[model samples]
Target: MSRNPRILVTGATGRLGRLLVPRLLARGAHVRALTREAGRAASLAADGAEVVVGDLGDGASLRHAFHGASHLFLLSPISPELAAEQIAAIAAAKAAGVQRIVKLSGSHWTIEPPGRSLSGDAHAHIEAALRASGIAHQVLRPNAWLQVTLARLAGELAAGDVLHAPPAFPKVAGIDARDIADVAAHALLGPEPSATDSPWVLTGARAVDHHEIARIASALSGRRIVAEPLSREALAQRAAQAESPYVAQVHAQFAALIGTGEAATVTDTVERVLGRPARTIEAFVAEALAA
Candidate 1:
């Protein structure tokens, strides 16, 4: 409850947690980072945060990770067993006297009325667990990440080939992952804002149709890459042919959501939280392409 609480961050070796740890330390929070690999601890230690080797499934390791920490950052990625993993982490945080939790949730997924989709269903279960755990917390449902487009299509784009997957007509707002981190950091470290308990639908200040994203990507790279729309079945087939298992699953999920037009809506949570306009798709593409 005091300023600069001891914070335990799960998934310290991950994209979001790795970025979050440094920011938390900058705010003077004593951070204990949890990573499955002992080798990864050096990086966190180098940054002046305590690193504990642990897994979300291993209760003993989690207990060690949360010892003396007053706040927990929970970001258990979606998988076949996400609900169990999140529940374990939440239980450990509650038992260890952790004061608050900041859960990283899916953007367009919802299960309030009991949807059959895995993401929606799983996220809802996890949220219910967090609520039941009785921990003071904030839930951030960030919009579809703009960075995934680069990461997922890097090989295809690098070869100057068209990304033949979903339709370019679907309207989806792309939010930068950095903005998500900024909001999470503010919630964890800033003076407790009045809406900390509320669910924040974080999104870019503006929405960009997929067609525009494809056009901008082509312009930035000097190559014409068409975003070919495909049927749900065709998209699944394409994902199955991809080299990375992660990308394959993601494409399949996005294809389904886009088909249903679930991801087309936009929100202004980023502006509401950070008091500034969020980054645009063009800016994201330009920076990523340059990188």
Candidate 2:
């Protein structure tokens, strides 16, 4: 009789990890959630995860958390140290004999040749470590998130009629974070991922621009909102003050290719993996407005 897979989830208290822990828990998997802050993970412990305090930068703590775990869910916030930290996690997982890893990776379109984008380069480095470790792993490459890219627009609409934002040209297939969580759960708890199909590129059902976003918001909220570009100085300031300068620089790279239509590819990965249509833009907007 085999025991249930003991999965270790890093960043378990974060946006995607918090959502994923519940999905794995609902399926009766044995889960160990790793957090740097012990005080913030009580909810995870209450949900039946063996909450353990561990830091990616602190190897001893990571090994202690990884002990006896059969699988790993790897995620972290954007930072200049992202590459080194996740690379360390991969090594720790290998030493602890963890059999599988599911890594939420940078979007595929955002990656270029080495040194092109800081975050992209970071993901690339961590992925290389995963491959070298000879562990079974799946990498999920999700596109623009509705939570980050579009949810704020709803709040701005609530404040006034006119949306103080430029009508962007790029058609982004922004995905709901819930969809991302769902796909990641499948990778972690479902059948082992094949190396040939190791990396999954995920996006929404259709592409939409800021103008379409404004149009949808108008219809949903019953308010006539117009899209207007913010000042260059304002945009630059926001990027400059971004929490992770690495992320800020990578976003600038993404901004440079906005009009080239390089990131508009929509995939059926979520549908094929989950056996349903990927959640649509309208659904995302409806939920955003409701929130």
- lDDT score, residue 96, model 2? 86
Error of model 2, residue 30, in angstroms: 1.6
Residues 182-208, candidate 2, lDDT per residue (tens digit)? 998999888888776667999988888
Q: What would the TM-scores of all predictions be?
A: 0.86, 0.93
The clash number for model 2 is 2
Top lDDT hit: 2
Single out the weakest 10-residue window by summed lDDT for candidate 2.
161-170
What's model 1's lDDT at 99?
A: 81
After superposing candidate 2, which stretches have Cα over 4 Å from the reference?
A: 1-3, 112-114
lDDT measured at residue 155 in model 1 versus the true structure, 0 to 100:
58
RMSD of each: 3.2, 1.9
Error of 1 at 60 (Å): 1.6
Candidate 2 residue pairs that clash: 165-228, 166-229
lDDT of candidate 1 over 1-291, digit per residue (tens): 866698888877787887888888888888888888868878888999898888888888888877888988888766766778888889888888888888888775444346645666777788889888777888888877766644555555665646544564666676788888888998888655343356888877665665676788888888876776657787556677865675466456655675666666678888877888898778876765665
